[model samples]
Target: MGFDARFLELHAAMPRVSEADAATSVELDYVHFSVVLDTARRLARVTGVNVDGASLVELDRGGDDWQLDERIPADWQAGPAVYARNDLDRGHLVRRRDPVWGSPEVAARANAETFRYPNAAPQASGFNQSKELWLGLEDHVLAHASVNGMRLSVFTAPILAAGDPAYRGIRVPLRYWKIAAWNSGGELAAAGFVVDQAPLVDTSEARTPLPGEVPDLGPFRTFQVPVADVAALTKLEMPELVEADRLPKTIAAAGWRRLETSADLLL
Candidate 1:
């Protein structure tokens, strides 16, 4: 099975891709998550996963191997080739541990499914302040959700901006976004965030590396943004999530709030 739209008490539909790009996009369902791959960009347009904090399972990832999904052509995915001989990391859009819940066998399958290339995005290898904060967001949200029903629905994807610098026939995204949805008491609650590595990514032609050259990328800058802003930026239709946004309207009017730590989160 894949991500359940009704995983939470309230339903959260998967983000939709635009009609123009729909033809080239392939939706693939994994053990506990789903990815809508933008073949044209050789990356995922959106990925959704269901996390059950109460049932989470811990398993060692000692010998897992990254592989392409056999259902889709290798060319349609930004596989090992893009990350080969570079500082770019094959980042997981749906963090591996999020979906690795349920039974031991099921958790193992979920863990393996995460290694498929469609769920991977190219991110800077170096860790910095913002990147470290970005990586811890899900855990913080999960803990918050535990007070309610211990279930969460998370959506994530690269911005896929046209201006992103080109590398190995694919454009490297400078920004990525995440939306976490859960039930707060009897109401649906959600928060949106954007993390940028623009300064680290030198887009200048002279600095943009030739094939096989490692492109220089800088530290990440994280922000708590409006869900509506995320919808506008990625051209995804997610009215419900926007309406359920837990970020204060006052902060939304003030614009994106730079987040130095989880304490900066309004949710």
Candidate 2:
């Protein structure tokens, strides 16, 4: 009953992505899987930030609800230190709820750097609470790892996605993940986490670490595809803009891409 043997037996894909590239370009240093932020963005946009006025912190922190751990990489210690006094939570792009999640203490380390004000934004409680749904996404894919199999990243970051009325234009990428299934067909999701940019700031400076926080490689994106789909996860859009925004070019320029951006060719 362990995960698909292919996930363990298959050679690790090319390291096509790096933690930095995602924040800036499509380039990366490692490639265990592929990604697609456009889809998640579309979902977020449609779902909107309708948390009923609750806070992200109040949402269930998995409370040991997930099956995996958020491994804390040595990379986090080398980056800008975050200020704990700030209200930001160390958010993970991949959810701990995932049955295949790895590491626990490290998982905790992979939190959204909300401690820093530069990365504050409004998010729907449902988005934060949808842990089960996200995990469901991961479960399906990992169970059948194949030629096009992929794994979600555990990187974490600050956000500025829409839901927030404060940081109205900031979007924070994350490493949190939850697997998703779109059909009985062969297609799989390319991304798990969404580009949540809460409405908040106006600083020209990208999110920098505070007095006590360091750069964490925790916040990252995820992807799911067939055993053979090698194309990139193209930018998808909300149903409202699906036809008009096929590639979701705006999102790509803003910091979100889709699985179609590249195929499962994580090399």
Task: Please give the CA lDDT of all the candidate structures.
Answer: 0.88, 0.26
Residue 246 Cα positional deviation in candidate 1, in Å, after optimal superposition: 0.7
Q: Residue 29, candidate 1: how far off, in angstroms?
A: 0.2
Model 2 ranges off by over 4 Å: 1-5, 8-15, 18-83, 97-136, 139-193, 200-267
User: Which ranges in model 1 have alpha carbons more than 4 Å from their true place?
Assistant: 145-147, 200-206
Can you give the lDDT of residue 265 in candidate 1? 78
For residues 151-244, write the lDDT of model 1, one tens digit per residue.
8889999999998878887899989999998888878889999998776433464465677565566678999999999999999989899999
Q: For model 2, how does the per-residue alpha-carbon lDDT over 1-267 read when each residue is reduced to its tens digit?
A: 111213323221221222433442221111122122222221111111001011112223444222111232322221122323444443333332332223444223322221212112222233332333332434434444331323422222223134322221223333222212221123322323433222234446446544344322232233332211111221222221121121234443444333322232121
